[model samples]
Target: MIEGPMGAKPEELDELCELVGKVFNWQMRENFPTLFCNDNTDNLRIIKEDGKIVSHFGFVIRDMIINGCRISVGNVGAVCTDENYRKKGYAWKILDQAIEKYRADGVDMFLVSGSRSLYIQHGCTHVGKVKNYAIYRGMPIPSAKVKAIKYTVDDLPVWSALYRNEPIRFHRPYNDFLVLTTSGLVYRPDSRLFSISDGNKIVAYVVGSCDNNKKSFGLHEYAGSRKAIIASIPQWFEELNVDRCVVPVNLYDIEFNQIFHSLGIEPDYGTTGGTIVIINFPQMCERLLPLFEEKIGSHIANVLTFSERDGNYVIGLDGDEAIISDPHDLARIIFGDPPILEAPTKIPAEGKLLDVIKAIFPIPRPEYGLSYI
Candidate 1:
């Protein structure tokens, strides 16, 4: 198989897209190229067999300061395998190559919009969970003196200033900000910043895109006061012309549930957002240890255990005398089905599997609407 970046000729891309469409049973959109080759061109990888495209995966390598230290990470996406070549191990081969390339390129961490199983096999650990929150059309929004408007280019400088001042937990390039605001997806009512002003200061603003056929709006970003956020909900809904709005929710927050309940909105479904596997243990520990030391204190000496099998990772955490596995595995025990622990193992009296799950897979509360590769 031939492995390389977007330097492939135009005819090569068309052939690849055609193969992807045939395999996935969906039309590969014309916009797929922009998704892969835009700003982050270095991390893209394509697999070709005998001069014909077989599988494709896209990724972005970015460096971010986490807890005061710069850490390099690879964000993966746009994964697809040609259907005619199924059961031939095309995906595994491509991923194997990609992971090696990422390591060679000096990425210490990897994250993707997939399940724990996908990255686990690649020596990655499940460090977090991402859940989608939805507000139905009938939900009652609390009254507040907040306002919102569609985003515009003139507002970019101000928005960029605000974003840089209080950066979101996740990483995003400035160009992505421009793309989301200008593309038909995210909307702002006026040329100037469409925002709610608390007297003179902007309080809360909603940034998102809509899927017309599904009548659903996906929120990419939100900022400002809680009161402003609640007050602007109705306008945000009407602007998108959608019956429901969805945003990612962190599992740790009780406030999210309270807000949804108070608004008379019930979530339609909650799916796994992304899978994480710890590749460089010491590096990851070095980066995140201080945060744990300061926030959770030193009650538990954290040690993570991970295994690779079946093209997925099976992650387990050991602390003191306790052992824990999958986050959903723990959730099933507490909420619905029996726990999926493999055998009798030591666990903390108060340390539910969910706690370990949360520790390994900490979900970031905010949503990233920009489809960056």
Candidate 2:
């Protein structure tokens, strides 16, 4: 009795959660309330056999800002298959269906929470660049004139305001924001939210958790002033009483990176936030027009176009064009690849075209943080 690579109906929700909990050993409805709710049945793709759902793949759609431009992104997670059904291609089939369904629904990209072979073979790549740095306690870095206080329900307005200031971030509606901060338990263990304040005014906030086994504090998400964010680290270290604090710095965050460099801390460059698949490159380029204008001029940004010929990408400005032979390389060009790569994709343009591509490209990739699906 094998049937369906189809959408999960509302009635199948409890069964779906049972399968998810059986696989992951935790209730999906509890950890990811936003995604596994009764209303989200349509987004859950599944395969049923022997009178039960044996395989599942789900995604939640949300709009995210990249340098002020909003683009639809599908946050894919909770993918699972019954142990008896592994290697039968059910997961792959469901993934293909999900992509097709979402693309037609106008989703520009997908951000999977896992970098498994299933995602890699489906054109999802780990091209978003970041640097991981460990700052040990008693480091010479000076603490700022700020106090770090645990976040409370009363601070929701200011918290949302500070998060909105992030140039590249999720378009989290108030309800979603509240749900994520309060209920998103998938974000490591014992995670806590703290607001950094200068006297009475809140300047920044961080959401992270301590790993008792690693004996370290991890800074997962932060917003507001980069300087304030950096200055508040030492205070966190002191409060947590950890020997080390692990910080992931986005490659495009120059000021934050510079501050770390000033402290003489070397970074280990790596790919973060799982793999990504660019479903509609043309739509991505179209939606990013504002970011392009901000980088170059509107005169040049307005003329840019993106298209796919065969399996390669064609990026054009005015009448000049550059062909990207590999989709992975094209993604790296648009976002970023690790700095340590022996061979990274080069802009295949010359003169003004090259300059424009360099100035605007490799835009900051949005960190999942609390928005991790």
Candidate 3:
């Protein structure tokens, strides 16, 4: 067996691609290429045997500003393993190496869009759920007054500016921003690139792209006053002329949910949601302290113990004034299932205390967005 970092040879990438295609029963369009090439992010690892790659994973290094502090994060993607190598632990080995790399790179948290069970084994916890909502093409316009217009290429700057101001969390850089603006309509191919104008000034806007089939639209991010966003929806729908339009939902955002509800639309499919593992508890706690302080209006204390057993977690929460001996037990009461918790004992505590801890250390289950690896 051989294991190493990818090199500069194109032929090696070709072989790796063949291995992935065969294992996954998919075809490679142009062979394989170094994932790090031309991409600003550098979180990739590969496993090989006899110069033939057997498994691989990729990550992108990102920095998120939380409470005025920038936290380094690793977003995982491109997980694939050769079929013949299955059950031989090649995938586990590559993931272990990736974890070590993430630690060395000073990442405080890691995010992924894959099997929650597999990730939990690596100390990741369920953070949030992701939802995709789509409106089929030719579906009668749901009664909302908005204009749809074609977008051109001159609206990049406005789109980027709008994206930077939105409150949504982003997992990558915004350099690949592109904008298509025409007449009074705009299309953002990349999240950061957008379109805007206030009656004439720059009051409202929308940001998204057409689907791979070119017959539908996917809205990854959007910001502006509620009215502005509402008004632009129909315009976007008309411009795309596709069978469907999709957007992600942040379930915690009540206002966002309310807006969607008022529109008389709902999501089509459901999935487990997004996952985040807190690798550095202290760092994450410190970063979230201010938010907690603001929400609770008092100092907070808690002891969180996380253990891994048989690819699952055994968590214990103890605070100065309260105790939650087993998170799994608590899960049964709250979510009906211990989720991925390994222990089943429940701890009794004041409902207020439970609420406070939940607010601060929210297990985010985010709706999946339009963008995927």
Candidate 4:
């Protein structure tokens, strides 16, 4: 009989293999835990029952560069439960465990992929708008003075600089860069990394993965001069020559959004690529206060403070404070989602203040799926 994602042991690995293999048949069941482990098992977690594996969940701890600071993030993945165990509350329990693990481990944020509803119920909110689109046979290409080169270890610092230009991004150290560049995510093998260099300096770079099956093609990450990235897209698309290519870009990417808009390629705007749950609201607020103030002005931003009382988070403005009924809703406002105002409480952006807040936090640059496409 299948159990929940509660208890686990090394001997249960084989049974776990059968459970996930039968559910997600992408593998031949021969590679099991290694592929699931992604080469590291120190942080893997699983739940088993009656000497067999039933439900599973795993996470990887990584640092995201937010406003030039390293904010620890726990990326949750490989979530699965035995088909027979679907309604048994195993997944939620595992999710609870994960939340605590991340919080205790000092992770400031938690990121999970796939269904937003499932996570939203647990105080997480979908963040960032992404464009999923197709690159047709005759997509527009910009004139690029730089040439694309296969990315190498020596070019890591250059890539890091490019990545850092954006305020929010996952911090990929040289080792992580090597791993993803060489192997990508375990599931997607066709990933490619390249750089565009002008004369002697690398001006831009892009990382993308289009499955061998051609069913899924997408540009995952890009950095460097906006012009350089724009110029290189056409050539890259032409090189791949897939019937259709999908690309996801941050909603705040005015440069790219304008380019695509002018080219008649409409972006399907959305924030559903990934879900985020804030583990430490006070800390997040403190960290983001400067940015918030910078955007919304000192009047509103100065009053922007966060605190927890009686186990509920409340946003403060002066001496007044309003409890954020739902953490997800609070995330929505801070990240610049629509409908910024709420009934007056103690929150910084409440009632009429929302009008002021919206102007400042408009077009937030938050991103998800940066770890992969």
Candidate 5:
């Protein structure tokens, strides 16, 4: 057995499909033969055993806008290991390698969908408390008519803008968005992607699959204006025969909760959202400082600084003026989860320092954009 990063070569692509299919039960190769044909492959790390792919872990670096500033964020996905190779430390080894590589690559932060314990061991923390909204088929069937149309490569910029409607979201390139819209067939052949249009303008779009067993359509990602999203409801019911639609508060923005509340679709507060790992604390500070200065006023932002000790992350000024927070709390604080910041902490919860921190980092639950889970 040998370990190394695998290229998206013809033979390697076949092995990837086989390994992924065996472990995840998907026909990756045939469903999406051109999987990596256009995707950037600088970070497609893998570990092999006996001339076949056994384990894999990879990240795609994306340009993200936090507080109107462009920052590079690393999104980790496609993490899987061959079933026969499980419990052999292959995952840990590959994950460790991915972290080290990301650090050197200047990634300010890392985002992932699942696997909390493994990421926590690598200095990551699970964070965020977001509300989920579900619209049932019997709910009066909204009057809005959202026309669904197929999107072409030329429509990427429009889609990218719609995708980044949130305060915190990854900046997707044309190629990456293209891959996301089609990659599903690699996992599910019958998946669909379309732009929900209002007359000539594209209002919202949904990428999802249907579960025949339950007669439910699971939305992988949905983005656009609230009115647009709500208007598009008829399309889901008519085209997919989906009786229910589940979405996050961030996806719909602040208008989602209030509008749905009136319609009896209240939020479910039990969800944690996603896991975020800060790759570089000080670098993160440097990038966010300008935004802080603008929002919190120079009096506070001028003196504030970000640093880390041991494995703990924090942001503050000199002496005992620091705000001690873990990656989890920091992420929540950054995303404006009031409870986490206002919770018991060494930092002053309601003072000038806290005010400054909140002013700049006050964002809703971060959105990963088009290729969301």
Candidate 6:
């Protein structure tokens, strides 16, 4: 018999954790304390078969600030089904219910950690454009002018302060920051945090990981002065003795892109590390109205109307409008399509509609470093 597409009660978490650990082969409770803890019990949606936990889908609700406007994000992860339960659609059922539940709770979007066909079929997409840059050994980058030191637990206050300066970022509560950093669950198991200081005043920080062979570094998340960060890279490379360094710059980060461009280093285009689904497209766009007005002017933004009917989305401006039948295509345009991916042909390539989209879209998304589920 089947039971539940319901929230896990506190009593069921032990079994839930065990099921997730067996499926993913990691300690869910330990690695993702923010999501798996009792505080998030209701968010850990699950299915049961004759009193045994068989499927689970978990998420953490986060509020993001994009150009000072609040955009709610549901970070989905820890999803799995018992081996015998595969192909039964339990995962899909739980996912569907979770989305409906959170959408009502004001989750504007969902950032899923995986890119399975299940997500794609459900309107999730690889959106937003990012540029990947790499620095090889002896690449002639500037010498380090700032002092770099390994991050310490005591430095959380300073680190939090620095992170808050980002124009687009997660509104990480201090406790969540503390738990995530100490949990050692950054995207890479070998991830390390470094604080960059210019003469005793902290100017920047970076969280990076080295490959298994320790020959390359992946800069996952960085904050504060871009110049200071770039200056300290060579020092990090030399100290870690890694031959190469990788930095992913979001398209909205013009200053960082320009700095790398000035150095004659062209980057490869890519997507941010996960699939995203706009849970409530109209609400999300409404929240971004300030940003829309700022970029394309109040006249155009005020005249724009967003609507959806029968799963097809419409974005309009006065007389000209673009109707997107596929939600995935809509996600690409709303989030900014990577050139490597298909563009929204449904929208005019050139016109007032395109101009308005080109000016405002590809909203800057925060790199999920410590916030990763």
Worst 10 residues of 2 by lDDT: 180-189
Clashes of each: 21, 0, 29, 4, 0, 0
lDDT of 6 by residue, 17-47 (tens): 9999999998778888899888889989999
Predicted structure 6: clash tally: 0
Give candidate 4's root-mean-square deviation (CA, Å). Answer: 4.8
lDDT of candidates 1 onward, in order:
0.53, 0.83, 0.50, 0.64, 0.64, 0.85
Name the TM-score of candidate 6.
0.95
Query: CA RMSD for every model?
Result: 6.6, 2.2, 6.7, 4.8, 4.0, 1.8
Candidate 4: clashing pairs of residues: 5-47, 6-47, 321-346, 322-346
Question: Which runs in model 4 stand beyond 4 Å of their true positions?
Answer: 1-22, 27-42, 84-86, 116-118, 131-140, 151-157, 210-217, 243-247, 257-266, 296-303, 338-370
Model 4 per-residue lDDT tens digits across residues 136-174: 656666676877777887888898788778766877666
Reference-based TM-score of each model: 0.65, 0.92, 0.66, 0.77, 0.80, 0.95
Q: Tens digits of per-residue lDDT for model 1 on 166-221?
A: 33344556776666566523322221235556556665555655664647866656
Query: Where does candidate 1 stray beyond 4 Å?
Result: 1-35, 63-71, 82-87, 115-140, 165-168, 183-202, 209-218, 237-247, 252-272, 296-367, 371-373
* lDDT, residue 160, candidate 5: 78
Best model per TM-score: 6
Clashing pairs in 5: none
- How large an RMSD does model 3 have? 6.7
lDDT of 5 by residue, 250-304 (tens): 5325576777877887777533445677778788767776777777677777787
**Over all chains combined, what TM-score does candidate 4 have?**
0.77
**Per-residue alpha-carbon lDDT of model 3 for 1-373, expressed as tens digits?**
5766442244455565565566656543221122333342234467767767777776656665543445666666657777776677766776776666666667766667675566767655443244555655544443434433333354555555654665544433434333012221222233322344444545445556775677666665565555555555556655556666676655455665676777677865333444555555445555555555666664443344334444333334443233333322322332222234455333344566556555554433222232233
